[model samples]
Target: MALNETHDEYEQQDLKRNLSNRHLQLIAIGGAIGTGLFMGSGKTISLAGPSIVFIYMIIGCALFLVMRALGELLLSNLQYKSFIDFATDLIGPWAGYFVGWTYWLCWITVGIADLAAINNYLMFFNDGIAFTPVEGAMISIAAILFIMGLNLVTVKLFGEMEFWFAMIKIIAIVVLIAVGIWMVVTGFTNESGAVASFSNIWSHNGMFPQGWGGFLAGFQIAIFAFVGVELVGTTAAETKDPKINLPKAVNSIPIRIIIFYVLALLIVMSVTPWDQINPKVSPFVNLFSQAGIAAAAIIMNLVVLSSVMSSMNSGVFSTSRMLFGLAKEHQAPQALGKLSKASVPANGLYLSSVALLAGAALQYFVPDTVRAFTLATTLSTILFICVWVMIMISYMRYRKLRPELHEQSTFKLPGGVFTCWLVILFFIGTIYIMSLETDTFEALKVSPIWFIILIIGYFGFYKPRLKAVVDSKI
Candidate 1:
């Protein structure tokens, strides 16, 4: 399709480019920093030891390439609203259908996990007030509604909320890094008698303390931390200047990985040996509490709460947009494509919110909420891998079919098609790593059922209607 032709077609639709450069930047930042890093890192460290650092770095590098490919595609065709759009145009409508709904399901699961996380965080300040899982589920529903309300207001309001949310996360990481450095430089000792020192990283049974199996286990959870990084690509339709702001957001992935993941992990391990880091509590809170700073631990908890909220907020926004995009392409009900007078996809937003709320109710059914949440998270990560792999495949196809566009594009992905293939291999390896663990392997076993359902729905429902519409148009 011609660029102008596609542009004109979407111009008739109502979604506006209201998100500013600052919003785009912060959204990208928020996507990179997830609560998994705060809450899940401890488990990863215990499993992989200090080698978790390399796992994060390796995943970050591979995902950066995924973002680069996504960025190149979005910029290459301004008419394309998001990756889902280009996937359909470049690949096939089946590609769009599968990716769009899978992404929506991905965020729904993430939102469910975040709601459970937020409830657990709130109990920290409950002050002996007993809160049951049902009550937590109620609060989770309320929080989802509140975020949905914000999204219904205006895109600008959504952006503003994200900006502040991202800001809090940034400040929290910076504070943690600074305090960790101080403890290391001053040789501060923890209650456990683990003296602060950079040598702590390697001194405690070497870097790969748990051997290759443990290192492989780290990839399962570490990949979840990077789930939202591709969120920036979803905002392509609403971003002010895709060429400038989008590239800036995509290119900054490395710097974020270095500061947020690598340096943060290095300092945490330095202050407290990897072996001593509690697998249950957050390393951030643990480090401060071990140093006799109760106030800082409270602050870190609050920061973690904010991070979880930010992630859920982004989840709601992206999933709703995916539904809206699906509706526009006739992959979903026409009702979902309708935008309110405020230029928001109010229907799609509500639909996604309802799905998320249903997920919240899982707390009441599952006997062990933590285990259920872990399974949900693993399932979401697997679906995300599918989405990222689709993007890579789409980019490869874009290059082969439209080499002229690739040649003319100002921002070309380095390593081109070769890098795309490498990233695919990296994701496959991560999935293989996930399969080695029992919990994650269970999630992998259950995940394919979702795709099977999607396949059945496509042929049973969508294919006949789509064919009829095409025949009429022709």
Candidate 2:
């Protein structure tokens, strides 16, 4: 339980701090944007109309506080490599075990969904290459292996890969926004005779086109878009200067949310009326095609493909690190803790890659890939809520048990303990909203079985082993 004991245990074979500030920054940016925004926003806009803007802002604000709490914790104890490590120390070992395993499951679920999405996107290229679902699954598997190889090389290589991936996303978004603005300014009219104008956002039925129920429905899908926003917290151990770089990355959340989510959606809705936006197609592709761009689908296809790759790459990096942390804590198999000569957790990476291959199989065998993806994404979102709540809970406990650390801390969470509770309440409200819908409710109902299994594993395995370790130390 002592800090020195934990520190000494990892001092000999800890992960190297090869992630510079730039890599940390883009990783944070890339994490905030994902395939969900690119492909799923069409549905959200259809459901919430213009009100989707408020939905994203609300979620973004709440998660910013969550990241602030995480930033404070990581800085308070340099020995704590990731939030999972400190969750085990500050809350209890069981907290570490549950959160670590659930987080791993979260990414695996996300990777599965991404694989399915990648397959769907590949279909857009059928006109040129004649790709099939089987080929899509095969390509997905190859991409997973490629990501695993990049992660195994060195931490810097992983950073560099994320950097370019993030750069591509940023450029695509910037271009989309600029093009939308130009269309509005020039009073351009598309082939359908619908003129581009800022008034399209509310010209259909005033902001709440689908009413309050529709706005509420947006939360279920929109939350999935923000799944990996906390990937920066997982990178704290490898960041060059945790105190400086961590805060810089965390504090920029608001700007990223505004420009990336709010403004981008605002432009999309302004160019194309909410009523005209197809729920099944990406708004980006729809707007580009409407503007008479011949290869709009192909261009958007490539952009969306890059977004999926970025998300899957992050999944590989995060789950591997979570497994590594669990192994170090004796919550997982010991072999997962071993690092290669390059100071990478090679075994853990391989384990995660092997698990991701299941996504390919699911895509190939499942006739209803979309339904399967929906369920997996919903389950992943539920577990992510649990992880974020535990972070807030851990912060509250830190303030009570370690007031001196709070007093001496350089980066204190803005609202302190009060905001932690508010964030928890916000997450609870989101879950309630999810339960009101049929499709999401199914996943919500099934998600508890994961926790039940984790609980049984804790009592059956982890608890006794942890007690013995403590007893031997005494």
Report per-prediction Cα RMSD to one decimal: 3.0, 2.7
**Ten consecutive residues with minimal summed lDDT in candidate 2?**
2-11
Query: Candidate 1: deviation at residue 203, Å?
Result: 0.8
lDDT per residue for candidate 2 within 354-405, as digits (tens), equals 9998888877676355566677788889999999999999999999999999
Clash pairs detected, candidate 2? none
**lDDT per residue as tens, model 1, 57-176:** 999999999998999899998989876799999999999999999999999999987876777667668862536768877887888888898889988888999999999999999999
Our model 2 lands, by Cα RMSD against the true structure, at: 2.7
lDDT of each: 0.87, 0.87
Which stretches in model 1 have alpha-carbon errors above 4 Å? 1-11, 127-130
* TM-score top scorer: 1
Q: What number of backbone clashes does candidate 2 have, counting pairs of residues 3 or more apart or in separate chains?
A: 0
